[model samples]
Target chain A: MRAIVIQAPHDIRVREVPDPTIQQPTDVVLRVLRSCVCGSDLWAYRGESARRPGQRIGHEFLGIVEEAGHEVNGFAPGDLVVVPFRWSDGTCAYCAEGLTTSCPQGGFWGSVGSDGGQGEAVRVPFADGTLVKLPSAAATDDRLLTALLALSDVLGTGHHAAVGAGVRPGSTVAVVGDGAVGLCGVMAAKRLGAGRIIALGRHSARTDIARTFGATDVVAERGDAALAAVRELTRGEGAHCVIEAVGTEQSMRTAIGVVRDGGAIGYVGVPHGSGTGLDLDAMFDRNITLRGGVAPVRAYIPELLPDVLDGTIDPSPVFDLTVGLDGVADGYKAMDERTALKVLIKP
Target chain B: MRAIVIQAPHDIRVREVPDPTIQQPTDVVLRVLRSCVCGSDLWAYRGESARRPGQRIGHEFLGIVEEAGHEVNGFAPGDLVVVPFRWSDGTCAYCAEGLTTSCPQGGFWGSVGSDGGQGEAVRVPFADGTLVKLPSAAATDDRLLTALLALSDVLGTGHHAAVGAGVRPGSTVAVVGDGAVGLCGVMAAKRLGAGRIIALGRHSARTDIARTFGATDVVAERGDAALAAVRELTRGEGAHCVIEAVGTEQSMRTAIGVVRDGGAIGYVGVPHGSGTGLDLDAMFDRNITLRGGVAPVRAYIPELLPDVLDGTIDPSPVFDLTVGLDGVADGYKAMDERTALKVLIKP
Candidate 1:
């Protein structure tokens, strides 16, 4: 089997690795049909997040179950399935509370000794609890397949941000960041009935997609300018809900600044660099709410799947570039260099 | 008129000040009947919060309307009323959204040239928006009046914390701080039908009040010990709702530590010292929510008034000491020395 591996800073490669097998009674082996390079993967690629010399990479995928353990009653071989970024036992207290990311028996796909999703075949733990079955007929549908692949992480994450922000019908939403997650957040807010969405990003191509994703307004500015533009768009009152998809201090500050008094900020961006220098005093004075974290994408997949299947939303546009397992390195490079919004991988 | 003034750090004086009159069309002159020294007042008394020499102090009061300006439509002379710490124009968008503290036209009592609540008479701006009417007959009932006075700040602030933390029926609530606000938080949690309430405080006197207010368990520990105790009380899962009534960095950390994954912290203590040293990384990883600020007490006064009137909750117990207007200095001294949980002032 071949999979993406993080060798060092700015170094990602498709290397031959041992094939994954069902090691636990609850585990199942998956033949990866589709996967992708995430903005978060860039953390390791840039050496921003530490990674071992030959560690497996990537955490998003959709696959067909090649083999199922005896304990996996919910799935069988040849069944199409979508995997959330993290695996969790559905019956755990946290999982029951819709916080699967905090499940005690859960773990990430590419942690220490696990199989990376960006490979030909990977082992999935807690199969019955982790994998959501996808329609077998959708495997041949490129558009639907890509959208379902997004459910593995990005789209679900965007939906989490929206839920955390308390987005409602007729709400004015402001989304920070123009990354794949941010674009999906625009779509998610729209799907949740947001009357208007303000996308703050300077990138033309991404902003165009944002508009198509239902962003009623676009603010191609940064810092105070962006805040001013958003405030101006919302008639100086700011948005009712702000989705923070960029996990930077400035982005967090902008999210805080552009949210209306008493409005909430749903931040799904993986915190980086000074870790969201949030000013408690300012937030208190404004009566603002800050919620969200590593999204419990597993809990959201079921609710969002029907929308993707019916084409109520087409998140596939986020994938402007596609590559095969052999070109995984190029996919990483493209995302790192900002040449692609997101890369779809055909394994 | 006489008023409590902060001459300097550790120097409180009852000084004769000019009598207040209707200043704005929306203003009303109130003959203060009851005012109280708050935990926040200690900030100015300790010189932690800078104040101008001889600045009038106090922001909680229940009084009789002495005079109403032409534009004061909701209130009239001789009407008994409770005033929130801040006065806001009810028609503002933020006020309409139930965030009276963020109203654009709102201003805090004792700010700059404004008359403080501890004064014999106060000129209240936005009278129609800031004051909640009290039944005239209860004015002579010391117990009822004391509880109603609490609705002016403490009780309402506690309710804001519970609401911000998303308190629901059957929630496990944890209150950090045993001050008047935290004690009131216990009562507020019970009012919201919380299944269990855990109070973290070291003072026996305050914790005793907490129990009567509905704390099912008391953890009289600090720092790590308190965290461990709370975790144990909730079966290592922590509380679903945490009320942070102490604004210190340590208190914020404890609130964060005792909150379960996907739980929220409603912090109402005016941030002092280094402010809430929030670790966004930890908060993000745990999916914890942080909300609440200077409470919009005016928005909650109505809902809580009926309960106070019926003796369903008696927040007046927070006032452990009482003083006349002439003994305002003694009231400040008692509270600053921690001999009093809260001081009631009669003018």
Candidate 2:
């Protein structure tokens, strides 16, 4: 089986790896149809995150069930499904609460001792719990397939940011990034009926997508200028909700600055490095509601799948570049060089 | 007129001061009837917060409106009122949104250039906005006076904590302090119909009052042990809500530790000192909702006053020590020595 592996910093390769086997009754084999390069992957690709030599990398994919374990139910071989970034036991208390990301028995794809998603095949644990089955019609719908694949991670994460920030009808939302997730956040806010959607980004191409994704305003500014622009747009009261999609100290600070009193910040950036601290005094005095973490993609996939299937939304545009399994390195390069919004890989 | 003044660290005195008079069209002179030592007062009393020599101290008080300015409405001389710790213009966007503590035109009492509450007479700005009028029956009711006084800060703050944490009829709440505000939080949780209340504190007297205030359980532990006890009590799922009343890193961490996935933490403690950073990675991964800040006492006073007046809750027990204006120094000393759970000063 050909799989994406990181041989070293900036060294992405596609190499033959042993095929995954069903080792447990709750496990099933998946024939990955699509995988993608994530902004988060840049952490390890750029040697910013710790990784062993030749480590399997990637955590988002859509596939067909090649084989099912004996205990798996409601799903079988030949079924198309969307795989969440994390696998969880559906019965855990956290999972029951729709926080499958925090499930006690949850495991992340490509994490230590776990299977990776960017491969020809994957051994999915808790198969029934982690895979959202797609209808047979999905097999022939290429456009819906791209949108469905997004439910595996980026789109679901953007939705989490919006929901966590309490975006609702008439809400004024500020998305503090223009990456694929940020653009999706703008789309999510618009879908949730936000009255005003502001996207803060520096790049022209990304901001253009942000506008297309329903951003009512785009500020190609940084630091105090961005904060001032949001405040001025919001009548100096700040936005009702701020979605922080960029995981950086500066981005979080900006989000905090542009949120109104009694408003909230839904941050979905995976924090990296140190000196990233919250201004507790400011957060407290402003009465800000800070809520966000990892997205429970599996929990949200079921709810979002119908919207995609019905063509209410098409997040497929986020994938600006596509390649074959052997071109995984080029996919990483396109994203790293800021030439591609996101890259999709075909197996 | 005589007033409580801070001459130096640990040095509190009753010194002769000029009589207060209505100074602005929106100002009114308040004849303070009752003031108290707050946990936050310790910060200034212990030299932790910057204070000028002979600075007016204290911010919580119940008073009689001695005189009303021409612009003041809904209040007049002889009317009893409860003054929130911070004064706010009722018409500000934040104030109108029920976030009075974050009002753009708000100012904290006892702060530089502001009138302090612990005095024989004090000029109050935004009298119509900051003062919650009490019924004539409160004048002769000493019992109700004590309960009403709590509404100025501790009780309202506790209510904010509970409400911030989303405590409801079936919620299991864990309060992380045993001071006045913490005890009030326990009481607020009970009033809000929390099914179970766990209090974390080390003092026997405070914990005893905690039980009396409606804590279902008390853990005289800190750090990991405290978290373990709460998790054990909740059958390993942790509480549905956690109220962090002590603004320390350890307390915040414990509150986060004992909160169930998808649960919330309502913190009200004035974050003092540094090195208090959030575990963003942990908070993000766990999907915890961290919402809190300075309590909007004015927003809650109207809702809670009826419960206190009708004897539904007796928060007066929290004021275990009482003193006259002349005994102001002793009041501070008793609280500083931890010999009194709370000090009530009759001016």
Residue pairs with backbone overlap in model 1: none
lDDT agreement with native, every candidate: 0.91, 0.88
Query: Per-residue lDDT tens digits of candidate 1, residues B233-314?
Result: 9999899899999899888888889999899999998887325467788889899998899999998987999999998888
**C-alpha RMSD of each candidate structure in angstroms:** 1.1, 1.4
> In candidate 2, what are the lDDT values of residues B1-347, reduced to their tens digit?
99988999999988998898778899999999999889999989999998999999899998899899999988989999999999998988778878899877889888877778888888999988899999978988998899999999999999999998999997999998888999999999999999999999999999999999999999998889998999999999788899988888777778888998788998888886321646777777788888888999999998999999898998999999999988878888888898998999998
Lowest-sum lDDT 10-residue window in model 2 chain B: B272-281
DockQ of each: 0.76, 0.70
In TM-score terms, candidate 2 sits at 0.98
Error of 1 at B268 (Å): 0.8
lDDT by residue for model 2 (A39-61), tens: 99999999999888888989999
Q: After best superposition, candidate 1 residue B289: deviation in angstroms?
A: 1.1
Question: Candidate 1: which stretches are off by over 4 Å?
Answer: A274-276, B273-276
